[model samples]
Target: METLANLEAFMRSAEHGSFSEAARRLSLTPAAVSRNVAMLERNLGVRLFSRSTRRLTLTEAGETFRHSIGDKLEGLQAAIASVSADGGEPAGTLKVSLPPTFGLNYLMPLLPGFMERYPRIRPEWHFENRPVDLIIEGYDAAIGGGFDLSPGIVARTLAPAHLIAVASPAYMRHRVPPVDPTGLGDLDGIVMRYLRTGRIRHRTMRDAAGREVFAPLRESLVVNEPAAMLEAALLGLGVALLVVADVLSALDDGRLVRLVPRWYCDAGAISLYYPSRTLLPAKTRVFIDWVGDAFKARKLAERFAGSLS
Candidate 1:
């Protein structure tokens, strides 16, 4: 039988299309990955991969082997997960990936409470603006704002995030507030650039007839970080489009004012996502339940109060 280590190396190489990428995923050197593949090839007495200076190609036998081995590997993983599901206090490290601004503003603040409730489960967090590959990177869970659900992942909606347009009180005092989205065309504003794609995105408003329209706002500054953009807006640099949760404190303190009342962009549901499987660990399930309850209660209270106004 081929060793599990060698099999894993081969699978990683196949998935990533490069020995170096596989090694990086496994936290090993390229040479180590190469050696593992070589060992596997020697045991099987066949060339698994044809390597050249420019690329690595799978052999005919290798393609057949991969198709046969993949299901066994998945079955083995599921069996291990089944064994790990034997209930106890959550005692392992849970690696979570999250969007930077939302994590900092909302999730991170709640973590202290979670930690106090479950002391045995240590969380390793990676907060970034870019998209994360949960399976390839071995992440336990991720907090995602977009509705894009990748294959083989389970997603649970956490909250409906609000996207609002705001400007500092100082800026508002000097310039006339735009009565509509079209009026915003002449105003100075800050634009947010996606870190991964480097594309600029702004919120547009719909007219009373329910037609979507955008303004020709000039971007005085473009930034990748949401926090930095918020800070710039606070300093009276220009107007900013940001998640409502991120600027709640500023809004309450009268530092920032909503650009258009009762008119804002709708961001789809934010969700907690994880690998899809028949069974989940007891600890992960408990945490998910707690988070759902907490956010739901908060949202209900907000809705009731909004209706009263």
Candidate 2:
């Protein structure tokens, strides 16, 4: 019988397309994953992966094995979860990935309350500006922006996100405010580099009369970090297109002002992305519920309320 550890390694390697990626997900060295695969191959007397310099491909035998074992592994996982559910008070490590800016500005503040509410649940948090594969990375959940949930995962909207054009008071003093999104083309505007798709995105604005305007922007200064862009905007470098939650503090302090009020771009909903809840561990479920309730009670919901619609 194949060990559960080996089965998990094989599943992760197949999902991630590389041994190194699978190793990272499991918090093991690449050599360890290779050793596990080698042991499995030795036991079965058949090769699993077609080794190459650039890519890892599944061999015919490997594909057959995966098909035969996938359902069994899933069943075992379900069984384990069912048994674990009988024990009360979620006791396990819950891993969550989140966007750095949103995590810092919004989620971090509510964590203390969540911790207090669920003392037995320990959370491991990873914050990044790039997209992370939840299953491959062994994450219980991820909080993300503007993502279309892929198959085999569950997604819950946490808040609506509105994209607005903004500039520091000092920057606005030297330049005329853009009357609409299209007018931004004539001003010095900063464009943030979106890591998931490698696209530079901006909000298109319109006047109260519905006249179209573009925000003056160039793809230069392509920053992948939201905090860095916020800092640049605070220093009065140029106009920034940002989510309302990200710049809320600056706006309240009079450091930054919305370039065009009553006219903004809809960026879609910010949501929590996770694997299927059918077999989710108790700790993971508790964290998800806490996040949902916290967002409802926080100011983020109010900010997104009128704009997200």
Candidate 3:
């Protein structure tokens, strides 16, 4: 019988197009993956991959083998996971990815309760600004906005990523409050530069009447991080386009206030992305349910819809 490890190594290497990348996903050294592939080749009596310094291209035989075994491997993995989770008690390392500021502000508070409930599951999470390749990076789940709908992944909408114009009370006191989006040109703006694209993000604002306007920023300060932009606005630097969820407390406590009440930007949906809905492990399933319940309890999506009274 062929070793499961060797078959998995061959499958991952072919999927990732590189032994190093497969190693990363499998949490093994490249040498180990290479050795496993070599052993598999010897056992099969056929060359599976065309080895190159920069890439690993599959041979015809390898492609044929992959097509035959790919689905079977997934089934095997699902079976193993199901068997391991015998009592539906989530008992493994739950790896996840999240956006930095949003995770810190929103999800961090829920961690203690989740840990207390799932004492057998160890949480391993990273806060990143960019979208992570969940399968390639071996994350169980990810929470963020603007992720590509990649193949073999599913997303659940958590909230709308609504943005609005805000400024410190001290900054707005000396200036005329903009009645509409176009009037924003008169004030100094604190704006965000896209970290991935390195381009300045322009604002597209819409009013309650569905009237849309393009408000190009006159940036007095350009920041890449959303947290920094919030801090700058708090220091009375200038008017800023910020996520309502991030500054809800500030707005409620009279530290910051909305500039144009009728106009706000609809960025996208904040979602929870996972590998497969059918083969979801108990840990991820419970976490998803818990997060959804938390959002409902807090009325997060409705309250942070950019219309704060």
Q: Poorest 10 consecutive residues of model 3 by lDDT?
A: 79-88
- Where model 3 places Cα greater than 4 Å from the true spot, the runs are 17-20, 29-35, 47-60, 86-88
Error of 3 at 189 (Å): 0.9
Arrange candidates, best lDDT first: 3, 2, 1
Clashing pairs in model 1, backbone N/Cα/C closer than 3 A? none
lDDT of 3 by residue, 220-271 (tens): 9999999899999999999889888888889889999898888889989889
Query: Candidates 1 and 3: which is better by TM-score?
Result: 3
lDDT of 3 at 31: 98
Candidate lDDT values, in order: 0.74, 0.76, 0.87
Model 2 TM = 0.79
Candidate 1 weakest lDDT stretch, 10 residues: 300-309
- The TM-score obtained by model 1 is 0.77
**Candidate 1 lDDT by residue in tens digits, 169-287:** 88888788887667776677888888767798766654334566575557898988888989999999887777776777788899898885545555565678887756665456667
* Candidate 1 local lDDT, residue 191: 82
